[model samples]
Structures are given as structure tokens and as C-alpha cells.
Target chain A: MRFRFTGIFDLFNQKNEYYLINKKLDTIIQINESMYKVLSNAKQGTELNCNEINLNTMNILIYNRVLEAIN
Target chain B: MKRDLNKPIVIHWCMNNCNKQGQIPKGVIEGKIRQAEPIKIRFINPRSQEDWRIIESFANESSDIKEIQVEYDFLEYDIKHCIDIDIEKKLIYLVAFSGTSYLDHDARNRLCNMIKKQDNFKIIVYISHKNIAESVCFIQSVYNEVKQGEFIIKPEKNIKNELTDISVLHEAISQIAELYKLFPDIKLSVYDEEKIVRDIIRLPYYMYGNMYITGDGNISMYSFMPAYNYGLSDPQVTLEEAWRKLYHEHATCDLEKILEYPRYWFKYFNRKEIK
Candidate 1:
């Protein structure tokens, strides 16, 4: 299934590491550079797939609500 | 009582109000402080084009401004020239607003980096609603990032919706207590000893004789209390004259009585009856 990032998540870079913070949930998690690139490249409302990133990472992102399945 | 006119004064640049309202009373900016000595001015939430125009005018017209305090969220442009000019003449105090949804993590990191390079900086965080845990986390993150500089936690004032719950106060106190345990170096701005003393003395805790300049170049005695606006700036009336007139007109028994009761005048002062 294709997925997109949720509005509650905000991306930030610190010490060359990317972090996704869920403001409403007050949860923060660090992500790898490749994951950062994939998330950053995915446009709003655009469906994201394993073609842009690995399935395992995409699954984790979807589970965290950082990405929502579109299809 | 005779007041020293030459003494340094603090002024608030109420940019948020000015940007929203378009203009402020001119009398608020023209005051005894301007005539006496170089003043310290803090610009709050200054982001709009009108706010920048006002800042430019102040930079051009006034040589008496000794310090400029600005928050990081509002700065979108290159203010290197402004900083250079101030460094040559006065001081610039960069401030960061912590523990709010106003700034994202990237912005916070950028702010922390900027603050680390500057000697004069402060991080002012607010505790409100049910965001004590979030605030604590934000403050801890900031503390870990920036080792130097002043940190203060201010209790947010509930004005419009009248959601002034005693529980919010309790939460803020508890949050501060928790913060102290986490970061003992953190400071409390609202409940400080100096503020308590000011409350006991029946005097306005802060911004007593201060002036506030709006975006449209208007002035008021108090920033938040816009009911006391003097009027627009006029070449006919000097700032000193405006100050004298506004103070003379408003510094009455009614104002004194309001000042006497902390519950009525001070927003930070929390009492059981206030809620």
C-alpha cells in the first residue's frame, strides 16, 4: 500500500541526524539519512511506496503515524 | 518622589499587536525614557513587513536605544547589518521562546546554534494548559543543547477564554518543581523573589513606567493594556511632552487601586479567587 506522512509529525535535523517529532503525541524518534531523504522527497498528499524506500522502514513509519497508507 | 530621568529604562515593542492593529498611539513611544538615556527595548513576535518597517524607522531615528531584544522565531531575514550596527553602538539580546508549538525541532536547533554563538541570550518557556510534560521535554532538550545563557519558565496568562484554572497554576508549579529536579540551573520568571516583593509592596511588578511601540509607530503606556494609548506621533508634541501628559492623565487613584490588587493587575499572580 502507498502511504503519506501525517500532519502531526514534524521533521528536524540535529547534529546531522534527522528526527521526527509527533507534537500531539509528544513522541520523538530518530531516522536514518536514507529514510530522511525518502520522507523529505515525498510530497504532501503523495503516496509513498517501497520503490522510494525499503519496506521495513516504510512499515515502521506507517506504524508511527509518520506515514499513512493511501491505498 | 523625584525620579531620575537619566536612569536606563525598559521598553516593549509590541509587534504582534502592531501587526494586527496596524497602528499604535504615538504618545507611548515619545516619553521621558527617550529623552533621558539609552533604553533597552524588547521586540516580541515581530515577523510581518510592517514590523520590519517600524524596526527600520527606529534604527534610523533613535540613537538612544542601548539594547535590542529579539526572539528567534520572528527572524526570517538576514539581520547581520542590524547586529553589526548594534554591536558597534549597543547590545543585542537574542531570545528563544521554548515549549510551544510555535517552533519546530529544526527551528529550535537553529535557534540553539545562534544562541550558542552569542553571549547575550535568554530562553523563555511558558507553561500552560496541559502541556507541562511537553514543556519539560522541550526545556530539557534546549538545556542539553545550550550549556550557557539564561533560562526562564513563565506561567502563561489566561485572558480571553477565562480558562484561568487553579489547576493550571498547580500544574505550572509542579512542572517547575520537576524541571528544577531535571535541570537545577533553570530559572522561574513569574514566581521569583523580586516579583513577590513587588507584589507585597503594591507596585506594578514589571513594565510599570515602560513604553510600548506598535508596528504602525503608535505608543501605549502598557503593551497589553491598549486602553491607555496616547495618540499618534505628531511633530507638534515632543515625546517627552506626550509622556508627561499620558502619565499625568492616567496615574490616578483608579490606576493606583488596580495596581494595589495583584489579582486585578498582574496576570501571573495566581490566587484561588482569580480562577
Candidate 2:
């Protein structure tokens, strides 16, 4: 299934690490380079495999509605 | 000594409404932003084709800017301008205007058409209470017709009085919260529950990191704070230094009052009257 970021999210790079802030969810998540790449790819319309990302991370993200599944 | 004080995260560029020609040159604006390198750039009431083009250029450019927003105040001349060019950055558009005593069908239609042409344009319809009394029917017509925007019903005089009286401010907040419950889309100017929480976490208070700069080079950290009085008058002080100083001074914030006052109306207010 394809997934996209839901609502408005601000991505900022600080001290060589990336963080994603979602104002609607009142969330600020520190993302590793790999997770950042996955999000960047998804942003560019790349199909993401569910198994490619950690199950816990995916579950948390989906639970927060940060990443919504799209057909 | 806060880390973010090293530089302002956002800088607002406000154009001269009376004489659009009185604006700082585009090259100078570009130079300042490049030097300051704020995370976001906001253009407030950019009227002419030249203004739109500058906005379009900034929107299209690949830079450190995470957001580009426009707060457009409609005058007779503004309805003719539209954002037709392609933009890479997502823009948050807040539109507020005072209405005449009568319904302006032509202006309303023009506004609707302009809104139709863009994506991700969230408008905040802030009508002055006096105008509301005169043009309630006009406002209602636009409200029913324009389904894409957010609405805020506030009084003009309350801009100062509400801030000084905390109880009245609380009542206003309750009223706005009740309004939100009735209509989920309508929100208090700066009181989005999630946004408030997010702001607290990210900064000392909501809008703490944001600063405004006028065409003539005056700067202010808060909307209510007069740019002329609290501006970057001292050439020795850099943008970052001035911001840090202001941050230290206003630590005990007027959070509720700040939320009540709309930032766009900062320009419209007479300097002598605000206090």
C-alpha cells in the first residue's frame, strides 16, 4: 500500500539530524537518516513496502495518523 | 542565551499599503533574507503584480525555508491579482478585509474566483465589528458562499481592552471555543489547542519566535508591540541580537491576549491609539 504524510508537517535539519514536527498532532519526532529517506521517497511518490520499515515505527506513525495509507 | 535566539525562525515582510512604491527594493529584501536565513518568510498584503512575482520567486526557489505564507488584506486594487504561477512550497493564505456599508457583489465574486485558483489556501475572515454591523448581510453572504475559508468574529475596540482585562479575554476565548464546537472549521486566531501545545513545546509561547519587519526597516517581535518603538533602530544590533533581547524581556508572556489579537491588523492600528 502507498502511504503519504497527512496534514501539514515541518521538516527541519538540526545538528546533522532530521526532525519532523506536526502541529496538528502536537508531535515532534526525531527521525534517523533511514526513516528520513523513506519519508522523502514517499513524498516523491515512491511506493513503500510495509516490511521495509520497522514494525514498531510504522505502528506508532500510523497510530498518530502521521502516515496515512493510500490506495 | 536560548539556542533559537541565535537567529529568528521566521521574519514577516510587511509592504507599505499607502504607497506601494515606498517599499524596500526587492534586491535589498532578498539580501536580508539570505543573510538572516529564517526558516519561513511571510509576505503581508502584497498588492501589485511585482509583489506577487516576488512571492512566486521565493515559493519556487530551493532554500532553507520550510514555509511561505501570505496574509492578504483586500482593498479595491487587490481583487484583480491572482496566483497563477506554479509554486513548489506549500503556502498558507490568510485573507481579511473590512466591508463597506453595502454588499459588494463584484468584490465578493472576484475574491471567490481568486480563491478558486489556488491549492492549500486557508483564509481567516476577520471582519471588524463596526463593519460587521454595517455589512452583516454582506458578510453572511460571503460566509455562506465561500466554504473554503475559516471565520473569526471579533470586535475592533476589544483589540486593546480585551488584552488588559483578563476576565473579558477569558469570556472571548470561551465564546470562540463554543464557536469551534458548533463549527469545527472556525477557530480563534491563535488558539488551536494542538497548535498551542506544539508552540509551548517548541518555543516559550505561541508566536515567540516570529518577528515582523516593515518596508522601511522597522522590526517587532509581537503584533501588538509597536515596530517603531521596539524596532531595530540601532544599527549595531543584528536581527538575532534584537530578537534575543526581546525574548528575554517578555518572558512573562500575555499568552491569552496574544491569542486574541489578530496579527494582520497590526498594520491597520494607529500607533498612538494601541496603548
Candidate 3:
């Protein structure tokens, strides 16, 4: 596998769900790297070491991508 | 007659103790050489372990096991330089207990050195030992995580329960796959239930993700973050209890198809940059 230095999911779709989104809607999503540059380096309710995805978006992540996947 | 010359050779670094107890299940060693057409297996067992001797005694010459060698802790040596790494068919399966896979500064350094010397070879290393992930890592309770259908962790202990959970998880992963398919890095590990005693007297405790998911029925998904030099939290996955049911009275796959559900994008910060 290629070494992903800064991106976790890199905006990719997974075959499985990380967890359920409808139920997991409350959870936060994490982003860093160029993707973070786009996301502004944030994950959920709080401003993590990175940034917060203060707003919702359209996407999918199996496991780590669970909540991030849901639109 | 011993082995198809066509197959490349794969070595099993049994070390004396580990391989001594285990023998290559006959047909596998032979048929795999033919069908998989990869390589013949070279069994390396330490001559000292009498327990392993008993297992090897069971094998006959017809088994087609190549040469048997003694002595070599895989961890200590730079295997790549010695082995014919050029042989694309070569695969190494290492099985040693705390003696080899232990997490110490010295041992870790040795292992890192060996791995660093590694080239294009497909190396598979197995840490043979008791399940100590519970004590060594931080395990936390995670509520119903159905999104990624399957959680990643080193599978250890409580098999009877893990199997049941896995079957369900598999189905969920399948569903998720249908929606958004494709992921790299898939791993599967098998354990020996050969010595485990099953009780027919009474049914073991089993629950479907309930508040009290009987101890026997849960699997810990340990998160090993590459970014973090240390380990990440390992969360428990007890399906029913963790997840609240999504009661969407109606279905909408057609809508999902039209929308072409977007993939989740997770950005990562350089480990050094993150404070």
C-alpha cells in the first residue's frame, strides 16, 4: 500500500460502514493534510489539534470513515 | 516426486519450539505447491523441543517437506541478505513467542533493522503468544459502530464469541460494500480451537449488543495509528448495545444510486506538525 503521510481516508469510499451515520450523526469527522487544507483541519464539536468539520458534508468512511461518510 | 520443481520455495521459520509443536498439515504443503503453484515449504524447527518432535514424528516422507534446518532466531539476523530474496515465490512465515516478538528496545530495534533491510519480498510474520492486547493496550467501550461494518484490531482470544460477532459484522460489511465498495488492506488470522473445551452442558452467555454484553461475546478493535508513535484507544464492538437501530420505515437505494453517495474524506496532519 502507498504510504499516506498526511491524509487518513483521502476522500475515499469504503465497502463497509465505520458505524451507522443516522445514529452516529452526533460524532465528529477528522481531516488533515491537503484534504485538511480543504477541510480547514478540524474534526467534530471541538477544535481538535487539527480543525473541526463544524459543518456537515456529503461522504462515506467504513470504520474511521463511519460518520464522515454520511451526507 | 518430492515437490514440483516449478513451484518456488517458501520457508516456515518454526524455530525449534514453535514448529516442533506444529507440523505442516500434509495435503496443504503438497496441494498448495501444485495448485497455488507458488513454492514448496521448508520446515525449520529447533531440534531441542521434544514437544515439537512429537508433532514432526507424525509426518511421513510422502509429505514432500524439503530440507529441515536448526537454529536461527529470525529477529536477530538480517534475513534478506541471506535468503534468496530474488525468488519472487518466496514467502516467510515466522512463529516465535516472547522470545522473538517481545516489545523491548533491543528486540524492537533488531526487528526494525531486519524489516528495513527487507526488499520486494512478501514477508508474513506471526507473533505466537498469549493474548496480552488487553493489558498492553488501552481498551475502551464504543457504542454501536455499524458504519464501517468491520472494525480493525489484532484478533485475540474469546473465539466462540468472536465468530458470532464476525458473521454479523461480515453481513453488515457486505451491505456497506454494496453501497460504497472498495478498500485496500484486508487481513484474516486463524487460531487453534483444537485444545479448547466446549461445554454442551449449558449454553454460553451471548447477547446482541446489549448494555450487559456478556463477557464472552465481545471483540476489542484496537486502533494502531501510524501517526502516533504510541498506540491509540481500542474500542469494544458489541453491536446491538452500541448502535441504536435506524428505523427508516421506507427504503431509498434508488435515491442513493442517483446521488452516488460521496466517500468520506479524512485528512491527516503530519505527525511532527501536530502538537
- Against the native complex, each candidate's DockQ, computed on alpha carbons, is 0.01, 0.12, 0.02
Cα distance off (Å), candidate 1, residue B39: 2.6
Expressed as tens digits, the lDDT of each residue in A23-71 for candidate 3 is 1111112223444443332332222321322333212222233233222
RMSD of each: 20.9, 7.2, 22.1
lDDT of 3 by residue, B65-86 (tens): 3322222344544444434444
TM-score of chain A of each: 0.74, 0.76, 0.19
Candidate 3 runs further than 4 Å off: A1-71, B1-38, B42-101, B120-275
lDDT of 2 by residue, B1-275 (tens): 12233456667777554554554555555555656767667788776677787877777777777778787776435533466435523676666554453326776676676556655544443434334333344444554566555443434432443322456545545544554464456323433332243335434212355666776666665443455434344444467766666566652243333444544233234354443
Docking class of 2: incorrect
Writing each residue's lDDT as its tens digit, candidate 2 over A36-59 gives 777777666677778779887787
Top candidate, metric DockQ: 2
User: If both were scored by lDDT, which would come out higher, candidate 1 or candidate 2?
Assistant: 2
lDDT-based ranking, best first? Answer: 2, 1, 3
Q: lDDT by residue for model 1 over A1-71, one digit each (tens)?
A: 66677765666554454555443222234566877767776635555657877677666667656778776
Question: What DockQ was computed for model 1?
Answer: 0.01
Candidate 2, which segments miss by more than 4 Å at Cα?
Answer: A1-9, A13-71, B1-5, B17-26, B47-50, B79-84, B87-91, B99-103, B127-140, B152-208, B226-238, B241-275
Clashing pairs in 2: none
TM-score of candidate 3 to 2 decimals:
0.23
